[model samples]
Target: MMRVGAVAAMLRAGAAVSLSEPELLGLAEHVRPGAVCFDIGAAYGMYTYPLARLAGPAGQVHSFEPLPVPYRILEAGWRAIGARNVRVTNAALSSSTGYQRLRLPYRFGLPIHGWAHLEEGLKHPGSSAAARIVEVPVYTVDRVCELRELPRVDFIKMDVEGYEAEVLKGAEWTIEQHRPALLLEIEDRHLGKYGRDSAEVAGSLLARGYRMHVWHRGRWNRADRVSTRWRNYLFVSWAAERRR
Candidate 1:
């Protein structure tokens, strides 16, 4: 028998229109005209649309969404807007190139696509959200850049649930080469599902000469504490910092 959420999802599967993108303060700061940007876990092209606008016609926005349903929606949304600068890919970014089980979790009998993740062992405590698994193609950020022959990368926004660390690992080469500003969504509850912690993720970037910052009071403030009220963090490399 199909789940209640699955039935509901099928009903809305053909809907190409995307919900309104949430207002994210400071997202425009990292993106610049003619810059190349990456939107990992780009569900329904929420950030992709805005990133493309900020990057302008000379810029490029590479969006990655692995799930079949969300991928379809994201593709349609971008196409509807005639976003010629945005390139949509139906794949997941990880530490290595391979296939992995993607967990699509539902809450209160409704599909919460943003909460979908790649961690199979994830257990959402105190939540009745059940997940259904699907195999997804995975590729490294380095591999994608090489395959695309990208000249440079300027900014990246990653929100792959608890898989941020794996994504960062795959993007090491790109980070070192381009020194692009990174905006990542990090939460302890999500990382704990994969037996990881926020410290480890922040440490990896910090060790790479990146300064962590959070958006507060309409500005980017240096994040002294790894964990902040806002789960999203901006990691600016020293090179980019110096240029700014």
Candidate 2:
């Protein structure tokens, strides 16, 4: 579970490490030397670890992940980096503060593996690779903020497969409270997975006073990630505007 070198390589390769942080190309312009960052759906701490480095000793980074395997991987990976400012939480975010079964998108080229297109929506519940269910505690961004007992967050990076909309919904209070900038990944196929569409996710961001923009599209040459070839939508607001 602890794939230290593997995951660390990912961070070094330019993973966001936090949604609030910009992608590699725009990182220097968007990120500050000491800013708090929240990484949602942190698979292996790829984004969280580097974020700690960016935040330096004064900044803080937090990762929220519900998938058990990935969560453990993240724990060990972050430990390897020795970023004391980083914190990892094994919790999923949804529209409300409760439970939800997160279906893993099929692994590429696994013969019997479900089609990777299930990001479009799971045609069957039993197609999961684990072949067994994994229950992960779920939370709202608001709940996370409350539990952390913090006021005013600097940034929030969110990529919860197809649940981006739901995650944003649960973070309503956090959005209104901190007004953190957002870098959200949106896949039409993944949106369909949760019986929704990317437009809905985009609409949610639009309503939150964010100046919306598409950073880039995730076009993989191979069937790499479950979210293969989805567009990544990034949102940022000027400090003065964010305060509004």
Model 2 residue 189 distance off true place after TM-score fit, in angstroms: 0.3
lDDT tens digits by residue: candidate 1, 64-116: 99999989988876666577888999999999988998877777777778777
Top of the candidates by lDDT: 1
Which sections of candidate 1 miss by over 4 Å? 1-23, 120-129
Per-residue alpha-carbon lDDT of candidate 2 for residues 1-244, written as tens digits (9 for 90 to 100)? 1233344345555445443323633433444667778898887665676566665677777898777777898888677756677889887777677665555544452322122221223443334464334566778878877888765677788777566777788888878776777777777665666677766777666666666654453321212122444355556654534453
lDDT of each: 0.79, 0.62
lDDT of 1: 0.79
Name the lDDT value of residue 44 in candidate 2: 68
- Name the lDDT value of residue 182 in candidate 1: 91
